[model samples]
Target: MTGRVRGALAAAAGALGFLTRVPVGRDGDAWAAFTAAPAAAVVPGYVVGALAAVVVAAPLAVASDLPVASVAFAYVLAVYALVGVNNLDGVADCGDAMVVHGDRDRRREVLADTTTGVGALAAVSLVVAGLALGAVAVAGTAPFVAVAVVLAAEVGARVGLAALAAFGSAPHDGLGSAITEGAGVGTAVLALALAGPAVAWPLLAAGSTLAGAASGAVAVAAAGAFAGALAGTAVVGAWATRRLGGPNGDVFGAATEVARVLGLHAGVLAWTLS
Candidate 1:
């Protein structure tokens, strides 16, 4: 391969290695090389991961003997397995940090504490419950729609993560800082562009149905959901900046989890209302 091709390959591998637990081999030293590439390149890794989720969920979704809850639980497990539990740890830290009544320093201290508090407990509960409920709702839908919505929601979640990284300031010279520090608006825009089709796929699926006027409504809902996913990310990023002094790895994790749930609900609501 040419040098440029080699770099692209390495960056892609870096993205998978960094974002996921999947082994991509250590030949290229992906963890270190990952930081060298623009974070936007990692977006594709999210797409790949989301696609895997869809594939895994499809069989369960179409199976007559399977329960929706089982499918949802499996889907959630598959995603967490692929993505790693590191972000969930962030949710716990962010929760504790948010509930602590103090300035940024105090919150940061709480975030760094290894012990889980009531706040952390509540945060994990809410996040896990939300994810399960959202997955169940999507799984209850038609196979095509279920796959589309799940795919879109996962993609939107990653886009939200990238947006948070791009728009929010880093609290310190930590992982969040390293990832988000130099990310520009262009990176966010690129993430949205990649996410757009995934978000819109449900609409296309809905439109292809013979439901007439309801088709239009589903399309509109899909659009609204997509817009909401993006808007919610910005709002959360700003909130984290104000409340915590800036975004951290925890905040990014929280934002991504929030975005996925929002996207899933938006898609389901659109389908229901239509």
Candidate 2:
């Protein structure tokens, strides 16, 4: 029992480590083990996300009675701001690079520079605002559930990028490679499975609300939404591949953030309108 508990805890640490650069230093001595423990990283990232949810949701719940929708939006803002905001930065950078310029070098420059440009400013603000509004509108009953969808998508994106970094590695050295070395196709698939529900369940609930169990039609809607989620990730991944010839830490961060929000929004919106 103790061993099982420890194993779970380690995996959680690994997950957290995978999300942030903290795990690499923490597990510095065990280079081989840390690099091979991909599932471990997922655990920590999820835990961190869950903790952020409590902090964000608790205050909104206590301070005032908000509509589920409002709280849902707040939760997203809080979660992103608290620990996952790095990914938000990625989205903003990607947007700025993709929109304001054409050349690959310029795009990479936009991504690498920590400075904010007009394009980056607009993209980040708009996205964060949309996420906050979406959550607030439907936060009443399923705020946490919605957040899970986001985090799950985050993990999925991470898993995919993990595979990308591992295989598409250039003559570079960074933490991204370390994570890729640790991850496997199995881990990536599991991440996708975890991410899949974020869209499907809320979709079913929303459909049930409006249609009262006509799931056949719900299946169609769910499939479309899921496809959109995939498309978002693919777009980002392709850009990263072309732009850098391989993903760097920045690209990885950007992809994860974009996919997570896209997944959450896609799921919640499907349910909200269903």
lDDT for each candidate structure:
0.70, 0.55
Per-residue lDDT tens digits of candidate 1, residues 89-182? 8889988988999898899999989999999999888988987898888777665556556666666666777777777788888888877765
Residue 61 CA error for candidate 2 (Å)? 9.4
Each prediction's TM-score versus the true structure: 0.85, 0.66
On a 0 to 100 scale, what is the lDDT of residue 127 in model 1? 81
Task: Give each model's clash number.
Answer: 0, 24
- Show model 1 residue runs off by greater than 4 Å: 1-5, 25-29, 36-57, 202-207, 210-225
10 residues in a row with least lDDT, candidate 1:
210-219
> How much does candidate 2 score in TM-score?
0.66
For candidate 1, the lDDT comes to 0.70
